[model samples]
Target chain A: MTKLNKKEKELVHLLKENARLSSEDLGQMVGLPSSKVQSLIQSWQKDGIILKHTTLFNEEKLESTHDTIRALIEVSIRPEKKTGFDAIARRICKHPNVIDHYLISGNYDFLIIVEGKSLQEISSFVSNTLASIENVRSTGTHFILKKYKENGIALGTEEMENRILVSA
Target chain B: MSPGFSHLIETIPSSGIRRFFDLVASSKDVISLGVGEPDFPTPWPAREEAISSIEQGLTSYTSNSGLIECRRAIAAYIEERFGATYGPEKEIIITNGVSEGVDITLRTLLNPGDEVIVPEPNYVCYAPLIQLAGGKVVAIDTSQTGFLPNKQAIKSAITAKTKAIILCSPNNPTGQVIPKKILKDIADLAENHDFWVIADEIYAELSYDEPFVSFAALEGTFPRTILMNGFSKAFAMTGWRLGYLCAPQEFIARALKIHQYSALCAPIMAQYAAIQALQGMKVVQDMRRSYEMRRNLFVGRLNEMGLDTAMPKGAFYCFPSIQKTGLSSEEFALKLLEKARVAVVPGSVFGLGGEGYVRCCYATHIDLLKEALTRISNFLKKR
Candidate 1:
């Protein structure tokens, strides 16, 4: 991987902290004109340095009725000679329930995070769809109990407390 | 009848910096570049330590010289970073803040009628603190030399009654670090004139381009130099009220007596947090990087707006000359706050050499800074 210049590194870190910040604000942060920042961001996007900008949700705030089941599925796959794990990974991600998937390095070839309406629904889908796929070896599924943090944001009631302003 | 206050207390003017801060607080929708503080909160580890210390009931007073472990951490940090050696047992005293450290050092070193040389356009508290210590302040005009005091000025300022000189590196308002050559020359002067050097290094860790040089680290100056530093600027622990003073054994012994009677010691919780801060060097580096980026942005924007500003080598403030706007520093600041809803400190508040400029702190959110700059641009165009 290529190393980012000082300005690029700062821009990336600031965006990671609060991606909702506007180009003007980012420009002010990294010492570029707004128009210049806009162009630089465009170039970064074209170069794939920035894959996406997303929001972090506080799931606890949702009504209990809206709560859903989520699980991490570690898949051991037998890679076909031509396609390796890429084909199987792509096919697995095609499921609407699969929120995120990553190629892995341990006993598992792929680690996938998926969400469903209920435990039974997720189990049925996993057994029927994931296990039935060709060249699939074995899978280990683990349900997520709670999320204390997500996407660099703390997900708890404590974060809502007011902070006292301090001056020097 | 009410007891009367001291004549010195009554005669000394209130801090001009505080006056501007109050004005900012009263106004609505004002974007301020007036505060000399870090925008970042204290690092998580330090805050966590403080919280845990309180949870564990570590709230009582510490030793008069502060917790020995905290002093050891500070000593290790200085030795590792600045190559300065001082015994933690006898050479250091934890202070409420560098503010208290400055006051204590001044009081310990100065006698009635003693004179101390102070550079103008500097941190506002130094001269007043000197006067409060019963010392006369001899002001040196460093504005003509790019805010760095020259050797000749120091020599000229020295007299039989001259006892010490106060120096702030990576200084406030002006943001100039005294160069190593200049520091060596000053050390030479100190030795020749037999005067002490009180170095306020509160912003030492925030230097962008060069490693900070400590006055005490220089040969022959350690004994005469009282080095003051703290967690406020570097670790973003301003509200914690933690700092320290390091000098020769004799000086620290004297200052410790004042500290015992007046302040006793820094808060026990803050001292615990400060220990964590010493271990959390990576966080300080991260904050420093952010401040460096903001400094570049703010100074570049000012220069593009036709304001002549020196690129600050350290700290989060930019001192820009408003002489081009054809207004006095106070006039410029008041008009900007009134018309643009952007608050900045008038440079004259700092001292004699600061009359034509204003101090704008860049330690604010980037969006607010952007808006403030736009408003300032608009206000200037209207003028």
Candidate 2:
């Protein structure tokens, strides 16, 4: 990957905060032409710097409606002679139920976040599917209890803007 | 005797902004772009410092010149940032805000009937304050000059009675920064005319496109300048009501006497808080960047909506011309509120040369700002 310039970094951070800003607005914010802004964003997308522009929803808010349990699974795997952890990490992370995956350091080789219908469903997946992988040694699964915040938005508490109606 | 007020007080009209405030307050679901101060709170560390000072019972008012440490910090900050210098002990006096600073400066300098030339479409308070101080306000109309102050016009307005010209670059309603060349020319005029320059540089820190040069820093202009600034807009502490005045020893001494008798000293906790405020330059820069982004977004969209808005080089406001909308600024402001539930200030509230325009403040959450712009766009389409 190429090193990002200052303007590119600003664009990235701005888009991270607000993915919905228009190219014209991004141009003004970063001091670039609108056409150039669109192309830079396209290049960043192609370069895999921007994985996706997606909304963050609070799963805790849907507890009364949706039947979903999120889990974080730690997998200890033996590295291949050449491919290291990348080969098995990719295989274990491609499951449809995996919400997020990362190759971690220390005792655990891989730490993945997965969502399923219930705690039983997540535990079964960790035992049956994840442990069955080639270089996987063992697995540990922990289900999430609650999330106080999601993607910078706090749950339950409302953001109130109380300004005097008009002031000099 | 009990019923009558002073002639000076009675002559001054009440604020034109009151009616609009009432209109905005009576409505619900309105996204208002009318406030003049920053949306952000005083930065956290400074607030914490104020809390600590209060809890420790360090709330006694310092010297009338304000806490010595705060004056020193302000002097150093002005020197480093705007290349201006003043002795903290003799030349700087903390005031209740720029509002009180202006009043004291006028009361100290102006003789009855002394003319003070104020460029119009300026802040609303300058004229009233000048009148109350028994000074004649010689108004200079800069609306014809892209809202930029013209040296020739100011020179024409000058008289032997002209005591000072109140300079508010990065001004309130129209965000015009007086250019360096023009400032040099104006300084020359003041030097030749032998009149004072009351510089209201409250918005100096918020200039975007050009670097702000304090008028007092210009050669020979120091003697002619009574510089007023505060921790209001720039520090996001408007409610704290803390500001200071810096000038020559004699000017500051006289202004200090007036401040001493009236407002006395700024709150002790706020003085301590301002010392801490000087340390948060990063927090200020972040707020400036956010304001710049919003200024860009709002100004660009206003132009697209057929309202011609000049991008304000500084300050949070954009004064866009609504003449093309086929309504007076007041009519446009009222109708927009009624039809779209979006509130903006009628430019007339800013005084002369503000008739055909509207002032929109961009110091709000971007989400609400975006929604307000959308409502305004729809309102214009319907028009």
Which numbered prediction scores highest in DockQ against the true structure?
2
Question: Per-residue lDDT for B3 in model 2?
Answer: 78
Q: Which ten residues in a row have the lowest lDDT in candidate 2 chain B?
A: B1-10
Clashes of each: 0, 0
Residue pairs that clash (backbone atoms under 3 angstroms), model 1: none
Tens digits of lDDT, candidate 2, B1-383: 48777877888888878889998999999998988888887788999999999999997878999999999999999999999999999999999999999999999999999999998899988999999999999998889998877999999999889999998988999988888888898899999998998889999999998789888889888888899999999999998999899999999889888999998799999999999999999999889988988898889888888889988999999999999888999999999999999889999888779999999899988778889988999988887
Ten consecutive residues with minimal summed lDDT in candidate 1 chain A? A159-168
Q: With candidate 2 superimposed using the best TM-score fit, by how many Å does residue B360's alpha carbon deviate from the native?
A: 1.0
Model 1 per-residue lDDT tens digits across residues B1-383: 88888999886898887777777777888887887788777888999999999999999999999999999999999999988898999999999999999999999999999999998888988888999999999999899999999999989999999999999988998989999999999999999889999999999999989999988899889879999999999998887889999999999999999999999989999999999988889989988988887787788778888889999999888899999999999999989999999888999998979999999988887667778889998998999
- Tens-digit lDDT track of model 1 for A99-149: 899998977888899999899989987899998999889989999998887
Instruction: Write down the TM-score of every candidate.
Output: 0.87, 0.87
In terms of lDDT, the poorest run of 10 residues in model 1 chain B is: B17-26
- Tens digits of per-residue lDDT, candidate 2, A68-156, equal 87988888988999999888878877889998899877888888999898878888898889988888898888888877777776687
